[model samples]
Target: MTGYRRVLAHLREDVLGVLEPGDGLPPERELAIRFGVARMTVRRALDELATEGLIDRLVGVGTFVAYPKRNIHVQLTSYTEEMTRRGMIPTATVLDFGAVAASDHVARQLRLEPGDAVLRYRRLFYADGQPMSVDENFLVPQHVPGMAKASPPPSLYRYLSEEYGLVIDWGEDTIEATSATPSLARLLTIDARDPLLKIERRAYVGRVIVDFSVSYYRADRYRLSVPLQRPRRAQQHRPVLRGR
Candidate 1:
């Protein structure tokens, strides 16, 4: 291992792990002298620790230990369902719900003309009493009867299957890392430059598009994971597409 790595290992094992939150680490010069390494090596080690969230650095102050972040595995279920399965009390607060004039991009996604009607659903998803994500879903008005004036449903997928007989046959989703916007930061109670997970999805029932949703998930409290395995001989010959 490099001198920096050795120093990092020592700090992680013998120091940082045992330190309480807000406990400050030694200055870089002090660590360098103690470890018999260059000051640059100690600085690099501390930089990595800060990136991993095991330490927090305040300019003009010092570097201190911090609480570890929580990681939530991704799954193929509604927020309500997944949080419930994890034994967390999930709540969806409707921020805005009603029919709205559609934009050209929104209309195209729902297979409607630019001026066509669309029902907009905006909600804040909370789990274990903490805000986790904000989602905005735009749906084709005719597909969901009376949704234009109704309160936002707690579990939209459940409502569709049970009340409207529409189940999402398939969906296209894209996820990426982005910094929080001013509005999003305010709602999620995070800094504007904090990292976030952006999810854009379009759900369909057979050939008809149902809804297009864009969501921002708090990265500190969430993680995206996918299951993978060696391809089976038979499956490799005839791959079966799956969704998660």
Candidate 2:
């Protein structure tokens, strides 16, 4: 007799492993027949998978594999470029923007004096209509006069290059994990205390700090990916045997 474990193993290897989000699972009767098991056994296996967040069960609808979290490259790029590379439509909402005195933290990142006038802006980044991150950025106003205007350009980096002849040649990024704030929870559609990935970036042109940004991304929906390579060693002319 085929037990639920056998059915589960087969499904995990054949169906769940290959299926993408929104891909429907076969009916319980079909799975039972395919696995040579009772229908009850098939249901039990699916129930366990649903509890593990690997699949979703909808009333009057078949089960489906859940979407895995998206992995983003850890390189310096705009949100628009990243989301576009993932085949998702990217958009941003300007939550807040105005001239504000720099906080101690912002001042340190931007190399400005405390309480110095700087432009502070907040934007909500989206991928395929789902909120992905919230960014709070600060910048000195002396270089980019167009920033003082009421409306912001679609792409901040593009705007800086086109309008001010400035470019982000290099940057420093710091990453950490933290709990979501109330506003962040609401905008990110996650629980108040859920884990979030915080990124602090300082973009620079030559020796000048152009922009400093603090961003929070949903941990459950986003992940950072990086490539690793082994360093090459110097050539060894001859191998000398050491004491065993």
Candidate 3:
């Protein structure tokens, strides 16, 4: 076996096997010395490990075991439910809450007039005590009256279902890639211009639009998992030939 391959196998099996996620690995020179390989070989091995998602190489910061990315399945469940299903504690902090005049875009989504009052709120969500995402939501005031005055609920879906009987029947989501701004960087504890997964959703209770929300998720920590199914082909009718 070649030197780098041997070093890669040894590091993958012996070194990383004992280390927990976020645990730092030895420097390249130390690894090279320990494995009796060239420093270039050690770097190559580490690069392969990083490509396989087993480790993270940060500039100026040494390499460390990478945390497994959480899969966010495309479903109707709320963030609280999703985190709980993944065996992580979920918590939320309400950053801002107030009634505001709906903008043209938000009003169109919520089926309200542009100048109509809407409850606007911002929330920071955490999973296992780590900040996961930030959500900004606009709701029609008539549907969720007094929500601004009341303490924010742990789960908005649960609150809507139980208190107001406004269960979300369906939702449409538009997803895009975005970069974190300075303000968002502070809230999410990430560097400015870091990649983020942006999801804008319009949720409906029957035919009535209940909520329109925009969520920004750290791309490194979360990934989308969507299940796809092939559509059935339509039957083709051929012209029947009579007696020729």
Candidate 4:
């Protein structure tokens, strides 16, 4: 990376440790002098930070730290169940449902022809009357024919298992940081360059892959929690508890 890029990364990490709303960043000239770079280079670094939602630049005033993000947990459960458990009213707006030719990645995940038809289900999810995520799902049409015609139940997994006798054995999921696309920004009411959590997941039933879902979660609204493994020695050790 260039010196300016390095300076930007350092600033991002440093601010992340101590940032609060209304806190001002160092002056652009000062930043340039501190990093031994040009003023334009410092400006570019700040611009990058602004795009990442870490800082906000004002015309007359200096830059300030943005608000801290909301952290949400992600678990392997029906969306209905997850939202209800979190004490939020969950609502869905179906965007589209139809058969489409699967991309190479989707086809490989579903173990089908490279261009085989797959049923696509796209929906926007809301929590507490706020848009929280966009979910796009793909599935093998042969396994669930006429699913688009069927009135979708409250939860997709529940309907699949109950109506089709398909038992979802497990799922593999991945999460990472990404910038919101222009259209997605409009839908979520966020800046197009804001960071977001992108999740790609594939669920399986026995040996067959049942569904693939790509979900984009608002970085300020969602987080994932994963259980960590305990050491074997710790598990073997006994703990004494006093009677209540």
Query: Of the candidates shown, which would achieve the greatest TM-score relative to the real structure?
Result: 3
* C-alpha positional error of residue 134 in candidate 3 after TM-score superposition, expressed in Å: 0.9
lDDT against the true structure, per candidate, is: 0.78, 0.78, 0.82, 0.78
What digit string (tens of lDDT, one per residue) describes model 3 on residues 196-226?
Answer: 9998888877667788998899987888887
Q: What value of lDDT does candidate 1 attain over all alpha carbons?
A: 0.78
Taking the candidates one at a time, how many backbone clashes does each contain? 0, 0, 0, 1
Per-residue C-alpha lDDT of model 4 across residues 92-155, encoded as one tens digit per residue: 9888788899999999888888899999888888887788889888989878877878875567
Cα lDDT of model 2 overall?
Answer: 0.78
TM-score of 3: 0.84
Q: Where in model 1 is the C-alpha error above 4 Å? A: 1-44, 48-75, 228-244
What overall lDDT, based on C-alpha atoms, would model 4 receive against the true structure? Answer: 0.78
What would the per-residue lDDT of candidate 2 be over residues 4-85, giving only the tens digit for each residue? 8887777776555688765899989898888887899999999988776677677786788865567756555667877787
RMSDs, each prediction? 4.9, 9.5, 9.0, 10.2
TM-score of each: 0.72, 0.72, 0.84, 0.66
